[model samples]
Target: MQFLPQAPTDRHTTLEDLQGIVTGVTMVALSVQFLQAAELITGQIAGLSLVASYPTGLSFGLVFFLLNLPFYVFAILQIGWRFTLRTFLAVALLSALVELMPRAFSLSGVHPGAAAVLAGISAGVGLLVLFRHGATLGGVGILALWLQDRTTLRAGQVQLGFDLVVFTLALFLLPLATVLWSLLGAVILNVIILTNHRRDRYIASS
Candidate 1:
C-alpha cells in the first residue's frame, strides 16, 4: 500500500515561544485564581497543590513548585533536556504568577459553577498553548505528553485517568460536593485537550 507524506511542521521562533509560554502560564494562573475563589480544586499537580494548601496553610505556589521537583529527573529521562528546561521555566513562572496575581486583584463572589467552567476553559487553552510551544507546566503534564508521544494514548486521556486518582484522594480531604464540582472542571479541561490537541492537525514544533 502507498502512504502519503506527513504534513510539514513549522518551528516557532524564540520570541514566539517566549510570548506563547508567557500567555499560557498567565492563563493558567488566572484559572488558579478562579479555583481558589470558589474553594474548588481541579486535578493533576495543581489540584494536589490546592488540596495540600487548603488545610496546611501553605502557599499553593510553594507546594506546586516543590512537588514538581522530583519530576524533573523523570522528564529528562523520558523527554529531553530542552523540554525539561522549558517545563521548569513554565512551572516557575506559573508559581510566581499564582503568588503575585492575587496581590494585583482578588476575585470575590464567584459562583462555584462559573468558576469551574471558567477555570476549565482557561486552563485547557493555556495547556494547549504550552504543548504546542514544546513545554508543559511540569508534573502530570510532563507524564501526559510523554505518554502521548510514546504510545497511542491521548495526553488528555492520560491526565483524566490520573485525575481520577487525585479526586479519589480528595474525597478523603474535601467535601463530596466540592469534589464533584471540581471533577466537572477537570472533565471540561481534559475534553478540550482530547478534542483539540491532535498532533495530526497541529504540526508545529518549537
Candidate 2:
C-alpha cells in the first residue's frame, strides 16, 4: 500500500510567506466585518476583544492588539522567536485590516445566521493559511498550536475547548440568541481545522 508523505519536503519561500500572511489576515479581517455586522462573536482573543469593545466603546483593533501583547512572551517561549515574530506580524496586520475594512466597505442588513456561517468559513480558511505559513493571530491560537505540537491534542480541539469557556463568559455579557449564533460560527471554524489540519495529512512546513 502507498501512503502520503509524513514530513515536509521543503520550506515556503520568503515571498510565499508574505503573500500567505497577507491573504490569511485579509480573510480574517473580512470575517470580523461579518461578525460586527451581526453583532455576533466567535472564539479566541478576537471574540474577547469584541466583548470588551462593545461596552467600553473601544475599537476592536485596539483591544485585540492590546490583548495579544502578553501572549507574545508565551508564544516566543513555547514556539520559538521566528514563529512568534510571524504571529506578531500577522496579528498586527489583522488588527489594522479590521479597522480599515469597515471604513472602505460597509456591511448592513446581514442576518445573524448568514453572518455566522460566512464568518466561520472565511476565518477557518484564513487560519488554515496562517498555520501553513508558520504563523497565528496570537493569544489562544499560540497556546492551541503549542499544545498540538507537544501533546496528542489537535489544535482545533484545544481551541474549541477554549472557545467554550469564552462563550460561557460571554453568556453573561451578550444576548443568549447572539451567543448561540456565534457558537455556530466557532464550531464551524474549529471543525474545519479539526478535519484538515492534521500533521499526518499535511506535512508542508513554512
Q: Using Cα atoms with residue i matched to residue i, what is each candidate's TM-score against the true structure? A: 0.96, 0.97
lDDT of 2 by residue, 63-118 (tens): 99999999999987777999999999999999999988978989999999999999
lDDT (tens digit, per residue) of candidate 1 on 1-206: 97654675579998999899999999999999999999999899999999999999999999999999999999998788999999999999999999999899999999999999999999999999999998999999999999998899999999999999999999999899899989999999999999999888786689
| RMSD of model 2 against the true structure | 1.1
Clashes of 2: 0
Q: Candidate 1: where is the Cα deviation over 4 Å? A: 1-6
Candidate 1 yields a Cα-based lDDT of 0.94
Residue pairs in steric clash, candidate 1? none
> What TM-score does model 1 achieve against the real structure?
0.96
Q: Candidate 2 — worst ten consecutive residues by lDDT sum?
A: 2-11
Query: Number of clashing pairs, model 1?
Result: 0
Per-residue lDDT of 41 in model 2: 96
Give all candidates' CA lDDT scores. Answer: 0.94, 0.94
